[model samples]
Target: MSEGVVARLRQRLRHQADLGEVLAGGWTGLGPSELAVRPVYLEGSGTVPLGELFDLRGEPAGRIRFEGDLARADRLAAGLAEGEVIVEGSVGAQAGLGMAGGTLRIQGSAGPLAGAAGPAARRGMTGGELIIRGSAGAETGARMRRGLLAIGGQAEAYAGHAMIAGTILIFGDAGPDVGLWSKRGSVVALGAIEIPATYRYACTYRPAHLGLTLTRLRARYGLPVKKRHFAGRYHRYSGDLADLGKGEILEWTAE
Candidate 1:
């Protein structure tokens, strides 16, 4: 894919911005001028055109990159249906809330609920890929229905709470409730994790599918995938006996 627009922040934002409408449908066909007209909602302020905050350039390629600090920007790429969105720095809460299709890669950390549902919705992401290169705060993939949520660094508490389906890959330490109430999803942890009491220890075996997934993560994100993880054994624990209990947590081991 060709490189698309790069929206560099013009100034340090004093208030949080709701960039939910910045990448509306058909964004791939819009040039810099058209794209700059998109709306941005500022907290404690009012609405403003995207041009006021970001300097936009480049052709209408099917991808976009945001440069500079965006730690107070929320709902970015929310409900994204197509194209690729990349954030060079950390983002505020709900970074990719309820995205249906496409790719969202955050080069830096992310705040809470990166791929979780919105406030009014009960279900979270239905499809697509969410890649967080840095640490993620709590409930990173809450109530996810489908797609891949990968955290290259630490995942805070309740990492994959109530996921209906899909996969979560955590390369660093996982906090509490890795698979709290997931129904049929998979939580793959390559770092330290505390198994939940509700989960039943399943088995110790290497799943052949991991080679492909980990390889993709390594190649696509350069996430420091080690040699041992390619063919290593993982301890499986199935749980959330509190719910349907079909989900599983795969903990990688040195043995």
Candidate 2:
């Protein structure tokens, strides 16, 4: 696929606008015409329509660029199964809820449960990558089954609650209870972090995969990826003994 569609936001939203179903599959087989015709809920009750929210144009090859501030836009990439979606600014809650596959990038901050499952849902972020260039609200990657999530800015409390399997990288300070109930996921902390008592210190060493992951985040998203973050020593802790105990927390150490 080629560069898909570009949707430029027209105005600040007074109600929720769901961009979930639109980019669900990452424009796999869809074209510009189909994409423009995709549905999106609008503010003030009844669905206003996606065309009303942004100026949609270009081909649909499974890649999309969203322009303008989407801070008020909720579910920007919910249930995505394929393609790549980029947001120029912040986004509202449940940004990538129940996302099965694909790549979703938010250039700015995000609200609560950024890549978590929806209400009554069993899993979150079943697959794919969700990148947050700025801060993320509470429970950023809760209940994720698989995929990668990188937060360039601070992450709020309970950032990776009950994650099944995947990786979450936080370049900035992480709040308390960052990975309380995670089952089997890796949380790499480049900034300050306090590991839960349930987690035991394993060792302080350089994890090769982390370097590759952080490097990608830096080069691709323009994150503040210093040399230290990639080559630095990290304090590895394994925990969530309450669950599978396969989860890990890598806290970067100054030494």
Q: Evaluated with lDDT, which candidate comes out highest?
A: 1
Off by over 4 Å in 1: none
**Global Cα lDDT for candidate 2:** 0.85
lDDT of 1 by residue, 145-195 (tens): 999999989999998899999999999999997889888899999999999
- lDDT for model 1, please: 0.90
Lowest summed lDDT over 10 consecutive residues: which window, candidate 2? Answer: 25-34
Estimate the TM-score of every prediction: 0.97, 0.93
Q: Give candidate 2's error at residue 216 in angstroms.
A: 2.4
List all candidate RMSDs to the true structure. 1.1, 1.8
Clashing pairs in 2: 25-82, 26-62, 26-82, 26-83
The digit string of per-residue lDDT tens for model 2 on 1-255 reads: 456788888777777777666766546676656677777776566565677778877876678888988888888889988878899889988998988888889988999998898889988898888999899999989999898999989999999988888899998999999888888899989889989888889999999998788778777777788988766799999978888899999999879
lDDT of 1 at 180: 93
